[model samples]
Target: MMCGALYFTPIGRRDSCTPSEFARFENDEQKGSKGGRIHKNKKYGFKFVLLETRKGYSIIVGTWSGIAYQGENHERIESGPMITIRHPLWTKSDPRQDIPIMILTRAQAEIANDLSVSAAPFGPQEFSRNAKFVFALPPRFDYGDSTGTEEVREILRNHPLHPF
Candidate 1:
């Protein structure tokens, strides 16, 4: 259970990340698990590409991000995640039941460690068992502004200036 720093961006249908960023991210993704080209270890689960600082573009893609309030017919069918993985960035705002699988870069994890929160760092042991390793943005990103912040807070809570 390597307590590492990880970065995550919801891969929306329209990825906001740039091509260079995307290419770099894609290369990293394959390193983790063989999503397409070649099959790596099942336990690796994207671990190979994700060990260091990684950038990812993902969409919650559950169709829920754009979902509006609906009737009973729209209820999600799944009872729960088939499994759980750990994320280093998650804090008290995050669930304890989930596993923080991704091994983040030292620079990335440093920011999380400084959040004035009582933190936990998982060791490398948990990697194979957990399944995913994410890289958090490096520190120096600022969270200082308070304008229109509520909207961002509803989800990311990332300060527009969050020095990443």
Candidate 2:
């Protein structure tokens, strides 16, 4: 699956100074799965979005770091801090056995509608198969103080995945 970031504005708000909210998952499959079951591990101070994908499901984990200004115009560029997809750390057993088939079917349909392609990209066989995938965000360059270096540093200090 392809992954990238997009800029979005909250509804009813239209001010340039208001930093655009950015969620880090977007591509052919995820464009449609805008909202999902969000699970927050408050004890760990982290949260994840449980998105239903065509084949099965995926989980995106991370938190929002801080805001930064971009380009010559110095436009706002806020990001979901250290976002990445996590696959089930499983072996031998099929993960689908645990999920209800009905949920998968609904999720698949949602993705198809989001795609809005003239022709269905996958056939019945593709839908029947079980699959899981993970994506890692590329390394980011520190924008120094412009991106709230001290804030990010503090967040990272307490980041759950800091060992990685």
Candidate 3:
């Protein structure tokens, strides 16, 4: 299995969000737990999405508040997940885990690990979790007169790819 890192808006602090926003990821886990869980483990609580999948699937929510312009460090992590993904726009249903899956390669995972977003949604609550799509692009071109990988990065920096 492979893990992929994804980016969204930079998350602030947990206290900044209203109860409703936090419920997306929080309440579910809390209810599932045995105790009347109220608090969440800070480590598991992130403003970003992270997951690794070969066959099955799971949702990934990230909580990062940083800036990476030019799509250099598009995502911040070691390895991204190896799952199929789909973006919110592709499927017009409420954004949830039900979205399609995405297939991510090592290079693509690295790119996702190096992404940065403008601002995180569901503010005051660390970060909001969203459904992402598995992104796939056309075949690579071997044009005689064209920029290489770096230029390609610029071209598809804002790819609508996510893991399942």
RMSD of each: 19.5, 19.4, 18.5
Question: lDDT per prediction?
Answer: 0.26, 0.27, 0.28
Write one digit per residue (lDDT tens) for candidate 2, span 1-164. 32122221122111111333322233212222455334333322333334332223233333322222333444332333233332233123422211111112233333323332222342111112122211122223223333234433342344212110
Error of 1 at 84 (Å): 24
**Alpha-carbon runs more than 4 Å astray in model 2:** 1-137, 161-164
Per-residue lDDT, model 3, residue 13, is: 17
Off by over 4 Å in 1: 1-130, 135-142, 146-148, 157-164
What TM-score does candidate 1 reach?
A: 0.20
Task: State the weakest 10-residue window (summed lDDT) of model 2.
Answer: 95-104
Off by over 4 Å in 3: 1-12, 24-27, 30-107, 112-164
For model 1, what is the error of residue 140's alpha carbon versus the real structure, in angstroms, after optimal superposition?
Answer: 6.1
Q: Number of clashing residue pairs in every model?
A: 35, 0, 42
TM-score of each: 0.20, 0.20, 0.19
Give the 10-residue window scoring lowest on summed lDDT in candidate 1: 59-68
Candidate with better lDDT, 1 vs 3: 3
